[model samples]
Target chain A: MQTLEMGVAEITMRLISVIETDEIFQNVMVRGEVSNFKFSGPHAYFSLKEGEYLLNCVMFNATYRHPSGIKDGTVVKASGAIKVYPKRGTYQLYTESILEGKDYGELYKRFEELKIKLKSEGIFDKPKKEIPRFPKKIAVVSSKTSAAFHDVVKTIKKRYPLAGILLFHTSVQGKEASKEIVNALDAADRSSADVILLVRGGGSIEDLWNFNEEIVVKKVYAMKTPVITGVGHEVDTTLVDYVADRRSPTPTGAAEYATPDLIELKRNIDISFSRITNEMDQKIDESFDLVERSKKRLDFLSPKRQISIEKERTNESFSKMIKIVVEMIKEKRSSLLRNFEAISHSKIVRTTELVPERLDSKMEMMKRTVSNDISKKYLSLEKMEMSLNVHDPLEPVRRGYAMVFKDERLVKSVHELKKSDEIKLKLSDGKILSEVVEIEENGK
Target chain B: MENKKVEEMCFEESYNELEETLNAMEKTDVTLEESIKLFKRGVELYKRCKFLIDSASLSVKEVLENLEKEMEIGEDDMGR
Candidate 1:
């Protein structure tokens, strides 16, 4: 007989191919007692034993539909395909489904019965208490040494250190766990905690069965302090979780739900502060605008403003009066010059004709008389012209003198004016309308 | 609400008072003097709230330690 020698890799490959192609091995259901059950990330690694025979099983993404009672010594029936791991040169069952044994089936039925009974009693439908938005103190009911307790403490400290924590330590799972939980909840309720957190880490159904106890659920329902439950992983919902005021999937989630985050609170405070300050600033600005408008209205009605307006009017009237006076003076002077020239021409003609017709003595006497009358007339005309030059209306105004008027009448004497009389003074360029504040009488 | 000093107020009390002060100041007919008074009070309330938040610390009660001692004594008696 010739013995065929095969390499280790070749033999392993052949074994893998044989298992993968076999119809019975490709799809099989095995029933055994579960042991060494552990989780790695999202996968479950465990061993199923029937007496001395043992089979290794691996469930990928086991969190989706993991059986409730999977633990050491739990009887389960798993359905999966047999596959050889090339790296370890070992075969394992890649499990797809698991069914708990009759014992867990009874437990599940009891859980359902209790749940329905409680629901019918309206305990589950009762209105839950409102959780404080900013809790000052929180009571934590958990195992003294559990990782869930530590996780909750760490998460709360990191998020909101303002909240004080009071631990109500107890045995979270055991024969006496339900009684201890009830006692702890009673103590927490009596404490001055704003909120109570009932928490435990994730475990198998049997491991976490204490939370499903009827006494524990009733105690949670009767708690005066609002209860927040975080008993297991996201897929595990215990009886106590339904009665709690709030339910978080994990211990860290419970802590986060109980206390507000400091960062978010500070952001809200900042928003409120800016809103208040902005409103105040707008009000102050509006007040200032109102004051400014009032000031402007007051200035428009001030006596100083009225005086300036009246002065402008008086200046306009004074300019018009000066123009008319100058025109009248020019016309009188031109007419007087024309009349003098006509009288002188007529006298010269009359005298010359008389000199030719009369005797010498008579002509001489007549010429003397005519010359004397002419001289007299010329002197009177010169006197009148001098008086006109002296009486020029604007002459005094040009020499820095003012013409005072009271009610359109020229003021010629101090007696025409009295104290407290409003009068107008015309100057060369403008006019001043003033009130007499005082009177100085010069006794003549 | 009774008039209390800002120093004597809790965080919620001070915060609520601050909100009230702001509301009063927001009224259109509020006089400048009244607004100024409310603003001062609001500032004090804000300061009190900020102080409370800044000085906060997590304090654990001593009941857990006493409970642990009682449990240890119970286990000792059981062992005996």
Candidate 2:
């Protein structure tokens, strides 16, 4: 010992190996009050204190998350291997697990910080993908042996048997779970699926921690395919749920969200078909009613009915005209008869026959009177003529008796005859016109 | 037989047309002759819609097998 010398690094290495191999320090469970918590470089550095003594401790990022809520002033029970940091000449506890004792202030603070950051960045505000209303092919990302898988499959089959299911089996818990889930998500994204459902059965907070990972959340946010997620119970919300296109409370709900019920669709079609058919029937009935109404209207406006009515009116007018004409004719005939009777009963007509007879009698009387008068005049003339003949001066001439007279008064006194005296000789035919040739007073 | 033309329409389009036809036929002013024509068309549309609904059936397929079959299908195939 007096002659041999060793380096400082060699001494530190020896001491660390000794403490690491110690039975008491190999797997120690330390119970103390947590303080001076500082997280950096994928690891958390903190101190555990009991009254006046303090021991430094470190927990890796892999061991816990912000939601685990381990912070200063919190009492915790930590279990891990103890080791010495030889370079710094100190020993610390390397914690693999932490159990909550008093409170989770640090975890809460970290959670609030992250939530605020993400909210400000609009990571949760992006437009969500639209879930297809009628999904023919659905891709399910879940553990094959989990009740969530069974629940989804059963529900989908019961609701919509026509929808084809594609299952992508993956780990849903433990350290490698998030990576596996992300890979499954990529696969589902590239698949010819109308929708993707990420679902899991209910579990403890730690058991369901992988869904809260930033990697998983980023992948969910970046996927082109629409994702519907149902993780744990209704209260257990994760970052992926916020980033998902659609979220459901349970695995069965996710399945429901992703597909349309075949029976329901069929029922809808049935309803629509019946509705249209009924409408068609009603329409026909309405058309018939309309046709019947129009027919009635047409009947009312029919030319035949109008013509019949007009014919009746015309016939009535014609009958009235005929009646008037007959009445007029009758009046005229009666008037003519009355005129003939009037003429027959006139005073002049009565007197016309008597007047002709009276005139004839008058004419006959006049002719008789005239004839009688003429005959009387003729008698008188005859008497006169007879008298004249008896006392005719020319009797002598007619008898051819010789009578001598002088100076024509009486030739009995021829003494009065002058020498030159006119004398006449009476003859039956005419008087002799002679001049006295001599004084013939011889007869005196 | 009179509705052979209607049978050629797509089932969605035909179904929509059927509803519209029924609505149009419901007009009160439609003549008897027009009503008769619409009724005939309505009958055709009804037949077309019924055939489409009746013919649509449920079909389920496995993922890999479905994908393989779909790969063989042309891009224009819109079965899904």
Candidate 3:
């Protein structure tokens, strides 16, 4: 062995150069259980151990978030370049990416443990709040640039634009996602929204693990407004889903559950409008019927109707009298004819021996007497018909004469009228009301 | 609820009032004048609801923008 004086910095620098030149240590993949995991600013420092063998790991860059399952004692496969640190004369693996082991047993175990613990605490058994049937505002907790957020917004706009949307933007996955989600949920709960929707697109279990975090689940449970969770695909269920008031398989479903359909609401409004019009029309018809009934009752008590009835009675009596007079005149004419025929026949038989000239003279005298009696009977019938015409009740009215009435009673004489008394005169066409200022008796 | 005008009322408020108006109109004892008044109110509510649904547009406001700014400031302080 050649003994040479070498500075510590120089030796470390040489070792670093040799390792960098080696292809075996570059881009190597290592598998072990993770331990002593911690974060410093944007960097992560941890150790990967396999029994007594340990490898120091350092992951730089603030944007890269470690897998949620790569916690203390978690089995993982990390890919990185092995580097030697000159300051401490130590070596570490600068990890570029990390993935959960094939079994994924640790994440599942933690999920199950939290599920069982929450179930025992009755957090899952709490009564869910009822969602508003017609919400005025809806708060969405989602990533601003995510497909899930766009899907939720589109569905809500299509279904119901009446509700205003308040977006609480947050990351859906990675190490800082749980904290951001908690903050978003807190903001949504304090908002004036009627309901909140927490949504994300489809992904693997590790990609959706933030929703399964205890902090996010607790924040969902503590919300005053009703919460609807749609974190992954149809088959995916997170711990937050159990604590949410409603669970939808996808973001679109969550938006639909939060809003009322515009078309359906319009249909209901139309139905109500028709009902109102129909009811009003029916009420108007009922009022018209009532008015018609009242008018009929009023017509029955009118004075014109009573006058018409009296006129009908008068006309009936006149017709009966005329029929009796005609029958009497016919019977008298028939009796006279029979009497003349009997007298002529007796005279003819008794004068059979007498001369023909004497018989002719007697027949002439007898015919003259019978004709005189028949003429007399016709004159009397004419007089009777004239008297009947004079007795007609409406005859005077038709001839421009009026019957006066006072206090709804007929005034036959001047004694029934008084000065300053109102009187009604019924004419052929109408009636005239008059005030009597003076009454004069004819040749009193 | 009655104090708010139909034009100023939200969709939920107007919708609920419309339902109540319909129920009141259905009663057998309502007078013609009362029915007419209720009918007028019902029509107003219906028109309001239709207007809300017809001319509506989605308005989305992000609540976390300020929070993101504050978080960025916090990260800068941590770096310092």
Candidate 4:
């Protein structure tokens, strides 16, 4: 209390200065499991928790080695000060030494954490999706510092150049690395990559746990992109493998999925080009065949056929017209003939009446003249009569000249004879019994 | 387009081309002409495959340019 009383401000300042200048700390390298870790602005706080015991730790923004990852549950050698937090009033370490550890306790604790978490989500039990046979784009998720990235890049470039590639730089192992991988996968999923390849070169199981994280595994499972895991060597199996669409032994193998062989692609293209062109050519040929077939069915160019068809039609029409005209002419001729018959009948009647009048007048004149002559020739009449005498119409008949009558008409000639005939004949002046049976061939 | 046989082509290029050709040929909708093209391309691919076989059969010494480079191969690759 007396020391505090003397020059209070200067003494307090000296004490604070001494406290600030003092290097009262111990640096240590511990081998134990990391536990109860926390991170606040510019500082990392964690406890190296061994079985039933704890060692406080701190890693600052600077002097914190292991350029990649550091978190709870990581076994590490840390160098720091065992100091009291003035604000919170707790004993803690301000760490400066930091290195990766290889203790069994640390490794097992992390392994158990990951396994239980992944098992709960069924990531380790789920069936993996199949990788695309032909990928248009490939996304690689791995640490840029790793040789695995180089192997993958080299193999992919050799195999397939046309296929696009997207690299996702990430922490390959250690605590919080799983989250980084998840973030990378999410980014890859957001991109238009055709396939996602989560790969790394061979390493210890602890070194490969980034892929085994439940977060990483869940991301792999949920990714719309097809993911192929190439974690560690052929013997290494991570939770990522169980949930990945496919698994490859190394980063080079992952590239096999990313891109096909350029030689193979060229040959395939050549073959496809040939096949497509051949099919086109065949189609053209088939169409030509069809066209030819149709043309054959229609024989539309024979002139002889046309001529014969025309001839038959013309003949039929000609016959019908001729028949019609002939019928018309017959009707006209009949009408004209009927008129001619009427006129001729009238003319004949008139001629017959005129002829009788003329004959009667001549006969009257002759009668008058003959009466006068008779008076004068009364005495001569006896002489005349005597001279004209004894003329008998039967004289010829009596002299045996035959006379014949047909239907009460005189027949001078016998030329109109047929097989069936009837004739009446008178011979001599007196009627004698005509019983003569002599038959003669007569000529008139 | 030149008549360089697949056997003479770079193994990567020939194999890739062959893969594409096979993919196109496998489609049922492809026409007869397409099929014929595929067959011809397949011939090119077959030649390339033959080349690969020949290459693989060669001894490591025959494959490598220098004797010293042989030592660079991984220890696990001895049998291979």
Candidate 5:
């Protein structure tokens, strides 16, 4: 009431503002082909085009991702807001859902209607629980007579030869195709397959209708192990492609992507071997050079052979020097003994001569003092000896101080020596040979 | 002026970031120092790319086992 006084223009402006910014749209579906898609971590930005009309959309990362991300040519049945961009004066969609292919909304609605109906009847929800990822046993849900089966089998063999492929033969096209395909899908689901492939090669739009059937789609959608749809050529579209967890361009493509290629593995191993070898070559070369360099630094000049030679030379010279020194020491020892003996004998002789000389000097001094008494005594004895010389011939022998003997006779002086007899003479220097023929005796 | 290629191995973002950096520097009007810095970044990417290529190899094997109870594979020995 207080603001009643305000102008109608201001009130109208307020109403416009409320209409522009405050209104929120509820769950409503829009269908279009995607363009200019941009993904930002947790968000996505894109636009959908329908002839002359274009709508901008934003998908938060969570809803945009469903088994896979959104891409161009994806026909989506999105449910979100028609919000205005104040800056661009345009309206844009804040998305909450996603569906695939053209006429996706209607198809999805039908799909969901049938899905709910079948699930309630336990036809779609209670088919089979699980398929194996690494399948030792596998059952296929395609026409046994179809090339699609052959292609799939061949591809599986090429990719993984050990896997077994069992056929759950079914019609792929025609009026009865949908029922048979659904039955086959159910059977394949119930078989030993770890993963089931609802595969059909590219065909006419009408030819692929079996996959588009709501029954087959439901069966595929509710699979436990994981259902892959390889239903057509690159351009072929089918309901199975949307409902299945994965879709490939062709049956072979599905098989190709389904498992890893052993060929690729072999190529990888070869390349890795080459890479490792190249690296090892480089490193090993470097290491070899390093070892050689270290060895050079340690004992560059003196090799083992040279060192051994030097050691041998030193040992030989040492032995030779020892031998020479030993001989010289023996000679010196003998010479020392001889010099010692000569010195001792000379000392003894000198001591004996010194004593005799001392005694002789004392005796000469005594004789000088008693010389007159000794002369008087010698004169008296000589007079008596001359008187007695006539009395005894022995006196003559005493005077001459000689005794002679010839044969058996004794002569005094030279008379007794006058005989021809063999005589032996002895001298201090040497003995001389002598023969005597006559002898004379001076005393006779 | 500087030649270096940047690449990312972990994620698309890493590669996208490298592409963005390259695009920015290749805009013809950058300073010499800025170009050099970008070149250094390119060198880093080059090293990482080479390291990955030289060190990583493709997977060699894939094994799949079927889970359905009805089918039996007695003769196909899979332990190998």
Candidate 6:
């Protein structure tokens, strides 16, 4: 190393040139706890420190105009340039501006104040609207470059492809982000979306401050369509989230809440289908039961079945009468044969030789007596058959007339039955079991 | 009650009506003639409901379908 190469002026100029040439030190932000805080007229001086390291900071009168004073131990985020003092040969942060960070307690106080104001105005206390059970359209408001927007869109498509999605790109952070967000909400409100999703990924309170703006909260509160928000992470709560109809832990969760699961929908439709089918089966079963009951009643009182039974009964009687008539005719014919044989035997030759005319007259007289007796018997049998047929039980009933039976006995006349007697009236198709309350007989 | 023609009902409406009709038919004790009438109406409702369910499907219009395809392509490119 060479000694005595340059003067103090030259060395100071070179060091200052180095400090100005550096990009980060030229304009930088140093966040640390404030100490040695002093505010004189028109000028404020402080030292920012973290643990053992410290940086000397200063804010000139031009940039130091605020009613709130900076005190010791304040955690402040200061932005300024690093400068080398020519006399002291020490570097310091030139005056610019400073704001409080999370540790400073001021930002937290502002958050609480806004929360109180909005709560008092009833903006956060409005009744939530009903989210559509099956949303046909969903509007998503977020930055196009942000993962939050993609998360929601992908989730919605994967879960419910039938829903039409409309994306409104907006700046999610920075000074203008709140206005952009409000405009997006307005557009989404006027559109035909069944639901609107306001979402952004996880970030610090400063990064998410736009969502906490009063304008955005009011817009969310006044939306016609229901709004669901998943701003920031689960632990981070924004005013917009409070005003939304539904809040979720993440962007994808917001999408999930907006539409129904495809499988669940299928199950519901399946349930409806099965319910209808079961009801139809029950109805058909009832109908069949009714038909069967009627059929049984009809079968019990069928006149045709009754008539067949009566015909069989009459046939049995008719056959017996015919057998008796046949037997009588046989007896009469045999007796006539016997008498002819006796007469023929006695006058076989004498009648042929002497008086064929007298023998023939005797035979003719015997034949007429036998034929007259047979005719009389046949006429009586026919009269009995005619009477039986006239009294056939089913004849009257077949002609739309009913037969009344009391205690298993046919009631031939009204006089056979008394008042209050339980009578069974058999009709052509069915039977009526009734009690005869009053009876009017023909005049005697 | 005014009678709404069965053919005019939507799928959800028709399905609900079919269930009601079937229940009424099973619970009431009317004449055979009246039962037959109920049965006829129930059948009509059942047919309408079945037709609607059978024809139900997921439909995405052409513009939206293109949007989906484009999204798929965009996702694929990002994957690569």
Q: Which is the better candidate, 1 or 2, if ranked by TM-score?
A: 1
lDDT tens per residue, model 1, A321-371: 888888888888888888877765797866875766677778798899889
Candidate order (lDDT): 1, 3, 6, 2, 4, 5
TM-score for chain B considered on its own, for each of the candidates: 0.68, 0.61, 0.67, 0.58, 0.50, 0.63
Q: Name the best candidate (by lDDT).
A: 1
Q: For each candidate, C-alpha RMSD in Å?
A: 30.7, 24.4, 33.5, 28.5, 24.5, 36.6
lDDT digits (tens) for residues B1-80 of candidate 6: 11888889875576566555555545535444554565566666666655554443222234446767998999999999
Q: Estimate each model's TM-score.
A: 0.43, 0.42, 0.39, 0.40, 0.32, 0.42
Cα lDDT, model 6, residue A274: 72
lDDT by residue for model 6 (A1-444), tens: 668688899999999999999987888777778898777777787898866788987778834352264578877778889999888878888758776765735555677789999999989889999999889899999998999999998998888889999998899999999999999999999999999999999876788889889999999999999999999876578888899999997898999999888888879988986787577557545544543443343344343444465578679889988998999899999999998787778866555755768777877887887788788778877887788788777777788889889998888998898889999998888789999988887884
Worst 10 residues of 3 chain A by lDDT: A294-303
Supply DockQ values for each candidate. 0.03, 0.03, 0.05, 0.01, 0.01, 0.07
lDDT per residue (tens digit) for residues A1-444 in model 2: 587578998888889889988876878777677899887888989989866779899888834553367778888878788899876899999988887765444544455566677778788887999999988899999999999999999999988887889998899999999999999999999999889999998765456778877788788889999999999876567777888899998999999988788788889988996797577557545544543453444344334554575678789999999999999999999999999889879998788858879998998999999999999999999999999989776686678854445446556555655666776655566556465666544545
In model 6, state the lDDT of residue B19. Answer: 54
Write down the lDDT of every candidate, Cα atoms only. 0.82, 0.76, 0.82, 0.68, 0.64, 0.79
List TM-score (chain A only) for every prediction.
0.49, 0.47, 0.45, 0.45, 0.35, 0.47
lDDT of 6 at A224: 96
Task: Write candidate 3's Cα lDDT for A141-244 as tens digits.
Answer: 99999999999999999989989999999989899999999999999989999999999998766888999888888889998999999888776789999989
Candidate with best TM-score: 1
Show where candidate 6 strays beyond 4 Å: A1-104, A301-444, B1-80
Instruction: Compare candidates 4 and 5 on lDDT and give the better one.
Output: 4
lDDT of model 3 at residue A166? Answer: 96
Local accuracy of candidate 2 as per-residue lDDT tens digits, B26-65: 5555555565565656666656655554443211124435
> What interface RMSD does each of the candidate structures achieve?
16.7, 12.8, 18.0, 22.0, 20.7, 12.5
